[model samples]
Target: MPWKHADMVRWLHPQHLIRSGMDALVASIFGVRADHRLIVAVGRPQPPYFDYSDEAAGEDFWLDYVADTGDGWNSTYAVARLLAKPSLELKDPNGDTHALERGRILVFGGDQVYPGASRDTYEERLAQPYREAMSRSPDPSPHLFAIPGNHDWYDGLAAFMRLFCADRWFAGRRTRQSRSYFALKLPRGWWLVGTDVQLNSDIDVPQLEYFRQTATYMQPGDRIILCNAEPAWIHAATTPHPRGYMENNLEYLQEKVFGRRISLFLAGDLHHYKRHEDAEGRQKITAGGGGAFMHPTHAPRALRLRDGCEQKKCFPDEKTSRELTRQNLMLIRHSPFFGLLTGALYLILALSAYTELGSHGLLNIHEALRQLAASLVNRPMSLVVGAATLGGLVGFADPAFGRWRVPMGLVHGLAHIACAFLVAWGAMYFTVSTLGICAEPPSPKLAAFIIPGANACAGGWTHMWAKFLLGTFLTFAGGFLVGPFVMGLYLTVSLNNFGAHSNEAFISLAIPDWKNFLRLRIDPEGQLTVYPVGLERVPRKWKATHADRYSPAYDPDDPQATDPILIEPPVRVMPREQAP
Candidate 1:
């Protein structure tokens, strides 16, 4: 589709050479200037801390005003949530006011407030601060291309759209409507595609479709900047399951639209800085640390590189000792909550198992412990004991035993119940012990044992203990139930197989000479053979006929490049009849 104005077409179709040429043609036709500077600002503004702070009283007070003064707007694009405090100030480095001339700066990303976009939230957290910052600026007017983040969508973005896009309707129409995604064409050779990546199901549908259509207008050598609230590339890495829309669309853009073009991606949901580069040299920058609650740290696969490395550092914060300390504390606190829940579940399961086994004859708690320990040392031996216990329980409940069987049944049931209870207790014991170990402050001696220059060892040790304990509990429980049943079933099946196969030659043959399952062979006669359940010789044409005069064969492992002509056949193209 052709744009009404030449500048508009250039801004919209930076990737399309034909469209760009048409823009030049239209500009000449309309006689308008097409050159302008473009800049982008993206940020997320919310309270910096997750929880309240008492020790930060003085710091908090200073931050309150610092937030109000709009000091965070150090960059060109004040792309931030208004609630992030300290709105972006458009000013000179020397503290001089600078008027935002037309086509100078653009605010390209983020929601203005967090959570539900209540009118109160907009006024208190966003509108008021934004107004104050604008008034303070020397030149209060600048074109802004703001997009809503998830929080803005909390209340369906009623207040946000009204506040930002009120003046410019969709397609410059007079009718009022709200949109979370839009495309902008700057006066310069720049095209900006802003998308809302809120968790809504519709984000991938309409938004991605629009982005693809918008890219059709772009030309080669023109810069296209894609702005989204969530770093789509990070989601690609972290999401355990595949969503075809995001994966396919991203692949299409990277291969087709962005091929050999200077394209940039901007996003802000992570609340921290992240830069990811792929094998193909594509880059994604996540500048989520605008002013929201910092996300808890987790082990990231990508490592930070040295300053001069070809691979850019993914996370600079992870390398800092202070950041590591904070991360360790967060990890310790997060893991135990799940551990506690699992322990409670196991306890309940243990009680149920105890009830079931108590009706059998095996009710001795002490005996059960002995059997458990013995089972660990010897596998089938434990199975024998477990089967006896089960049979005894069944016998005790049999009518032939009468009154005596009642007591026997009770004993057996109690014994089984005890075993089940013990399983949960054992799991909980280890879980609690590990938590205690982690909870205890590291001693000076223990600290010395840990790696020097590393953060606290408690987090690592706690994680290890939790995994070990959980694994042990699961193994014990699974073996207890399945071991006896599997052993008996296998014996029954084997006996049946033997009886059915009873014949003159009942014995199975064993090939002791054939050590490995399969062996490779090359015959001196130039035939290659494979021997296994059956023997087959390779076709004569497929066999290697020539060998190096100096060596037995071409050794790929040799520390030298192979002769290209020797290894590869020369290509010769002739008339179709002479192709062979």
Candidate 2:
């Protein structure tokens, strides 16, 4: 079946790209980080940190963490419904079951909306689905706290402020926090601190000061669970990178301000779950799998761990991730609009070299090949298309690709050029041979195309138009069928073999599987156990349940609706010891 538009976000969709690009440019110029200054000055919520030290559950309670959410209906709602459960029970391979209770506090690590942030998008992509799931949650509303991801930052935190900072009700969850970043001082000296690092740059001075002040209230032995939008540790580990600051800034907060008491570092953005643990048991975990399309965990850089931390566990695992990259072969299966763009490019190149194509039909392969080579040299428009293709691929290459970008981009771009020429020849053959639109084709070079007299005298406007329209349509059809194949093949190879285009390959897939979220429980001893839950698949068939009718508005019709699997065993972060 072809992709359902309602199920996933089409990142390549023109509207999304245009909006995201415009929003990013505007935010950079205006410096919207100032919104945090206004949020603090107004003091609407009065304080930067909300102290949850005296909860009804005392030192023991559940906390939910999810991020990189708000892309597709099926994926976002699938995770939302699971998170709203009164209790979630899953067994490890050994069959020891862990029954996790509903969280008293639900934290969105970042990227609450896909592509870009706008009130309408937030309302539909983030609010509507989560709220629909929340409709059935047996509740004493959970406290909702969130930090803005890059997409959220694209609109300068306006929509994020309206939703998360307004101190209103959302999806049966009470929204808290007066800013894009927040601090939750939980019971038994456990603190959950969320920071806003807009677009993976430095934390704003105001946000830095906010955390520094929040840090002042912490006790010496208190343990902090630090949450950030990006995994700076991963950035630092990967080389040809900027010397430090971003990671160091986070380090300064953890080491200087928080006194090295941060036991867990949590984040989202990559849209997959990965945990790295050091010898001392300090964990840096990326749990961005709330929703949105899957990011490949099989990529080489994704596996790189910094500061003596080993790769502890990851959702889908590396093997499964590699196998899934093969789905890129069917790129048009989801994003058909991409084919239109490629088809136009193919039509442009073909129309530009019409004299050559007409002279040597594809059946005359040797001469056609020679003519295409000459056309590339002689035809100005063909050269323009070739240059443009190369330039676009170079721009598409990720910054992380380093110097390898130019060569890899050149190869990928060349493939498209070759494919376009091949497709153009094929389209021309179909128009002349199969459709028989063109008349008097037995000619070389100028004679092949110099048939305005023959075309006009043959039949008049009807005959002329039949050739023009049919030729144009066949050219477009050839490109529509073959263009995306070339692109998808390049992306698949680039991502899996070359460690480039990780974003492009997976977003095109709109994979709703490997969906996951985290469940954290702080016991009486202040030991925090993290349970990473994963769904191998999301249900496409859903219906209103009549049994209780009070259950989640939609339930999967398939009895075998993908069961939640434990991505890994629970990870325990022991609290720091108190001063003697």
Candidate 3:
């Protein structure tokens, strides 16, 4: 059948009936909006840990299947582990919360839940946390804008929609629905676009369309904020060689699209804080530290920052000027108790070895006895080697063990060398001298050298020679030389792991991801500084007497002087556009 132009247009129309139906369903599910200043709070929601095996319905078929057999427990535990810490206190130490109230819109960056959504999963992980937050609010609340995270769509988003968007209608107009990729036009002439970058979608098309639409609506000097769950800027900053479509989209937006106007890109997911300005001048801020887990604290690389010191030469850069910072509440440590336990376990093994061998006077025996034992019962030698190897590995496994700071590479290298030497010596000795053999007298070419003959005598001598040389070398080396070497290796690995683990735990607890809290403040010029809650306050002098000032000594109970503190005129310029 030949297609007509009208038919082709219909076929290639921007809208699809099924897609529209789904959009309508989603709009109905989540009340969609396109007219307001947007504020977003990105975070990882915590879930409660449950003990399934100990429940009352232990025998029930469903319960047994879910919990008793350990499958359900494993799955639940995996998610619960991610959500164990829920409170991402993003509030600054100085106490500021007004910025949140001032913003007309709010967006959740990503990782709303540790694991993506399933029926009970959403209820257990997200709904409860959201409900608790809402309950604390004095009123119904501000409009929330959110996008799906990888975890939110774990089970194809069936449960997420049901919980977050199922029953909401569009503002005023009941029939006009919302879609995930909708935009909100704010009174401030700012357009907030929320995007979904799940597994099955392309971010380029919607983003380009958004840019085109934004250009149509936005005039010169207007601000356009694009929000995604992942920070495209940071991704590009960290990934020198970006491979996939997402990276390509990021490059295009950075290089071609966002240079003209005031555009801010925000993202979460790294569980750390990072801000980057590309060479072309665009700001990319990563506020992924919304309370799930603290990621390794990272300093901006010299190439990543314009004014930062060289990464290798500088131990720590100017702390105040870093665009990326780590903020956290609790500082947990690998309980010294674990180190004590590990030490005690090593002591016990060492003592057992001493008792077993020392009691037999093996330690004091002639070196020949050690050699005889090596050839007869290789178990003791094997056991000693095995124990030393295991101990060394355990030390390497954790860095909090003790003063020992051994590199695993060195230990592994030495062990391989020792094994190789022993094997070579053994093969040569055994092959030459084990079986008695008489070699032929040397010819003119080689003076007095004996060559192997095919007779039994030649083979016997070859075997005996091999056995003698190999056995003697191994006996001496394995007994006296390898023991101390193994012990040193063990100590090194143990100490390194112990120290490293302790340092890791402490840093994790001390510096949390700041993306979780709603950072809100009003500058003197009435400009809002909306940022991650827990960011360290940039040191600045407070105006001695400002219009919004109250007596510093005023009591908390006094109502007359309880006005919110406001900074005076000459607002601090927050760089609107960051360098790409």
TM-score of every model versus the real structure: 0.37, 0.91, 0.44
In model 2, which range of ten residues has the least summed lDDT? Answer: 448-457
Q: Which of the two candidates, 1 or 3, achieves a greater TM-score against the reference?
A: 3
How far in Å is the alpha carbon of 167 misplaced in model 2?
A: 1.6
Per-residue lDDT tens digits for candidate 1, residues 110-205, read 745432355665555444424322322223223345666655655545566666555542111121213555665532234455665443322444
The candidates, ranked best first by TM-score, are: 2, 3, 1
The positional error of residue 219 in candidate 1, measured at the CA in angstroms, is 2.7
Looking at model 1, report the run of 10 residues with the lowest lDDT sum: 509-518
Candidate 3, residues 436-507, lDDT tens digits: the string is: 222222234332213221122333454434544444344343433333333333433332333233223322
Model 2, span 1-580: residue lDDT tens: 4223355888766676677678888877665535554555456544857987888564468899999989888889899989877888898656778898889999999998887888988877888788667744445668899988888877777888889888788888788677777889898888999887776456666667888888789887888899988887776776555466445566667667776678899988888888998778888998888988998887646454656888878887888888888888888887888888888887876766654353346469988887667756766776786788899988887765677888878887888777777776666566655666555533343332242222232344554566666767877887887888888898888877777778888888888778889999888877788898888888877886554423566788766568887788888775355311
What is the lDDT of every predicted structure here?
0.35, 0.76, 0.35
Clashes of each: 31, 0, 70
**Model 3 spans with C-alpha error above 4 angstroms:** 1-102, 136-141, 167-178, 199-215, 243-247, 254-259, 276-282, 299-528, 535-580
Deviation of model 1 at 482, angstroms: 37
After TM-score superposition, what is the CA distance of residue 194 in candidate 1 from its true location, in Å? 0.8
For model 2 the local lDDT of residue 230 reads: 84
